[model samples]
Target chain A: MDLVLLLQRIFDALFNSAIYSSLALALVIIFRSTGLLNFAQGEMATFTAYIAFVLLAGPQPRLTGGGLAGLIPGVPFSIPLAIFGAVLCGMAAGAMTERALIRPLGGASDVALVNITIGLLLATNSLMAQWWGTGPRFFPAIFPTGAGQHFTILGARLRYSTVGVWVILLSALILLVLLLRHTKTGLAFRAVSISPSNAELVGVRVGPTLMYGWAMASGFGALAACLSANSVLLEPNMMLRVLVYAFAAATLGGLDSPKGALLGGLIIGLSQTLIPAYVPFIGFELSVLPALVAMVVILLIRPAGLFGTQRIERI
Target chain B: MSAQAPRRFTPVSVAGLIVLAGLLVAIPFLTTTTSLRQATQIVVSVLAVLGVNIATGYGGMISLGHGVFVGVGAFATGYYVGDLQLPWLLAIALGAITAGLAGALVGVPALRIRGIHLALVTLGLAIVFRPLSKRFPSITGGVSGRSIDARFDAPGWWPSDGRMASSVYRYVFCVLIVVLVLWATWNLVNSRFGRSMRALRDNHMAAAIYGIDLVAARVTTFAISAGIAGLCGALQVLLVPFVSQDKYPAQESLVIYASAVIGGLGTIWGSVLGVLARTVLGKAGSALAGYDGLGPLGEFFDLLDESAFVFGVGLIILTFLFPRGLAGLGRKNQVPK
Candidate 1:
């Protein structure tokens, strides 16, 4: 019943809401185009975060060991530049993954597609562990997070980092909206999402359009990872739990709806923070349980989700 | 019932069985008691993979959380044997039944959820299992897992009373149970119910039209599959005498599912082949990891030490090359879709 405390929790929850939204958006993009869930999305994003770490730290052999540090230039880059570079790498990797691993399947069974994505998840996860040790590393914050870096709103401290992340997310979203609404490639992507065969019939190049979608999705994932790395710490398994929340968000939003992803993320994020604060049994570590239960309930009762199109099955 | 053509065994398969039998017998003698126990554990893992095989392959429902059932079996068996002072065999049976009941509970939700959605739910279960198990300290041993006071040792009438004798006894017991389960599963898959299970998998609506009870078949398939995995977990406790939540990670479930896919899903032999492949790949990877002198490639070689890495790469390569899996290689028109 404490209004200020509740406001504080809600403000704190907004940071995670943005993160889940971006990751869920990434998932929605792929599902819309390819009708496949990228189980490896979290790991792929974490890998980019590591890349950004390497770029910022240069060739610190003690930190990176004999891993990927040797491959990069021996000069420490600025944080924004490093993140930008990592996002580009992430985009490239996403495009390549679709072309190499997914394209060859040519619409295989659900089992086969699941196998590929799960395979990628396992491989990338262990590869990261092998390269960088399993121990968590300290990642520098993008925004200034000093003791007095928060604004006082109704006696609650709203951190500057949270506001900064939201600004970046809104800008990126606006850019995405502009690109989708006023570009040839965006039209092709929309057409392909509606119907791949129809888009191909009109010569929109379905494969390349899907590839772009994957790239964009991966880019969003990279941004989420880099921004949140400082809070969560850098580790190989850092994103595993986050992936569950993101998946829940996507499912709640409607798997193939972009706006649903954003809304779902907001709801999931608020509940994730608020539920644990109120309920003693569902502690911090167990907050994911509610998201999962919500996902199951939604899937059972409303498969289409809030913003998604209902799927009609043919006998 | 209609008469069907008798099954034929290929010369290659006959030779394979003979070699496998020889290896199983020779394993205890050739290795130390420690390695012998490890070998027995590997053999026991086949049941878990087979569990995934039944649900994903024959039953046409993908279960990425079989490891949770295995954990349930181990934890339940430990509680029964240690706390209730039940006989080991009865405890093991009860443990499997408990896991089967749990599987049935999960299968109720699975009645409406299908394909990828079911996969998502199961994966969520896999991730949640560790934290959930940690909540029950008395049964699951909480954060650090508790050890069972009772040890599964050899009987007095066995020729020798040394540690090696007990190790050998456990090995033989595990191998016998694994074979018995395999034999039982082979028969189960060939029964009238098995045919209906397959029919439902291929097309549920058509199968339902043909008088197949969709709900009963799916739930039973999951229960039986989970029971098999539970048996594997019971044996794990019998071998190690310890149960921990750490043993059943989300990745472990994925690896188990990967093994089922890589080995060939539909065939029972595929489960064994998948486990064998995992063991061989793991041994080879560790051996290669021990070697030095590879300048730049040593880092890549280091990654080989992790079985998850090996299995991941193997899963992808196998998916590309042999979609039907290793059991499907060089054989045609045998495995049902």
Candidate 2:
């Protein structure tokens, strides 16, 4: 029985780990493509989740009701439409930020861009809060609402939705890796990432690639936000904690390396679960502390992050 | 020595300043209740901005945590003015000195790190200051926010509630600090030490090549800048005689930077100009007189949401248009051709 319980504990840990990784991956995507340590990504995600709530406000908020994500006889289509609307808005928001703030100061160094993003994060969140008001609103589960809907394989009960999250992340990761590996646009992105000046010489459409990166990032961000909002209702400060995790994951995985970002997310997720469970007095409040400290220390030692070996400028 | 450094005080300049100073000093006597309160707040921020000028404007180190130090000064002044009941000059001296030490403690880390990382650390201190002030409510008066009408109560010869006399006394306080700080900064900047800071900024390696002690200059600059920020914080604390963390939050740092840039980077007079713009344009300025956020125009145009947007855009525009800042005031002071 103890042996079965240990295995169960490990499986449970992995499931919990993957959830945080989803959000972390979104942060990593933006950081890798654009050299912006975007503090706004989480807030952007929160804003979209709030929008999703607004979209389903009139109809049934619960999935069983007549609203979006509801299982009501006639209103099965609202859920997917709400999700689509959120994704589209996220993409538009990302692009608008680029044009309004980043594009003008295109030639400026990364530090300036980073500070600009910080300013954006503060300003946008405040503006959104003013519009939405300070309240947590319900966001429907994309899949089934039942926690008991689990698959028993290898004598382990696997949550259908939890398993679905992993499958979605893995598929997306593979697609991203392949696109970067195989396509011309991906190659242009790689070139720009390595050296913008050289990429300009190579005649790659760098501006569009940056926009592409932002779009993909926001799309993934929307998905992550929607899913997390299922567990925790949407609030303006919803993404603040997740942003810190993603930053830690990105930093650990190698800030500039995409593969590193994936691994970084997994490692952070595991440690977050395992450390607190295994160690006495290592509670929830302190779980993120380790990750944050580690990232800062790693950056200090390796400046480029764990897997990042490139000589990125200090500023 | 180029006739004691250009202070925007050539023959024409002197006449302009004399008239301006005359007006500022004369306002209280001429104005009624509401105007006196407004003038007092303006003068308070002016002194506060002068401290910002020393570090960011002259030293080229961004210290957003200047507000914490300002609060320290205010609290110290509050203790001296309201509690200990010391005289104004003595209270100012003790408050400035006390705040300067606090500035040095914060300045030490700045000596190690540069730019945003350092800015964040100082900003973090500002974050800490709010909670810490409240935590030690005995000293800070916590959320209640310690207020003192003692400073407003004029001394023996000033005559009680005499608006003109009260305004003159407050104006004298601002003018004395501004003149003294500006004069000292001018002397410091024109010297070889000032050249070394500029050199380091232009090219750290090249500056080192000239045999300048890079660390010493950097640390000294931070120390000096911080001390000045502390001084300003102290003055600001006393200027209103209301000591609280709400008075000096992290946002004040941004205003200081904006004012410094708008006034003219490294220009003494520019710092004052930057303060003037901030006092007049932003809500923090408006807050001095008990107004919140921007006025109607701010809301209608969404300027309320885009507060830093204005500063960020303004900095870019100013940098492109005139890298010189308000230093134009010093042009004629170049000693008769």
Which numbered prediction scores highest in DockQ against the true structure? 1
TM-score of chain B of each: 0.96, 0.77
TM-score, per-candidate, Cα-based: 0.97, 0.71
Report DockQ per prediction, comma-separated: 0.73, 0.15
Q: Over the stretch A1-315, how does candidate 1's per-residue lDDT look in tens digits?
A: 999999999999999999999999999999999999898999999999999998888867676533465576655778998899899999999999999999988888788888998999999999999888899989999899999999999999999999999999889899888988899999999999999999999999888888999999999999999999999999998888888899999999999999999999999999999999999998887898999899888888988889899989887
The clash numbers for all candidates, in the given order, read 0, 6
Q: What range of 10 consecutive residues in model 2 chain B has the weakest lDDT sum?
A: B328-337
Q: What is the lDDT of residue B297 in candidate 2?
A: 51
| Model 2, span A1-315: residue lDDT tens | 465655566666565456556666666666666666565677788877766666666455442122443433333337657766777788888877766666676565433443465455555555555555657766777767486787776777667767777776787678777888899888888888778778989798778888777877777777678767876577766676566667677777776666677777777777777677776555554566566556656655665666777664542
Model 1 steric clash pairs: none
Q: What lDDT does candidate 2 reach at residue B246? A: 71
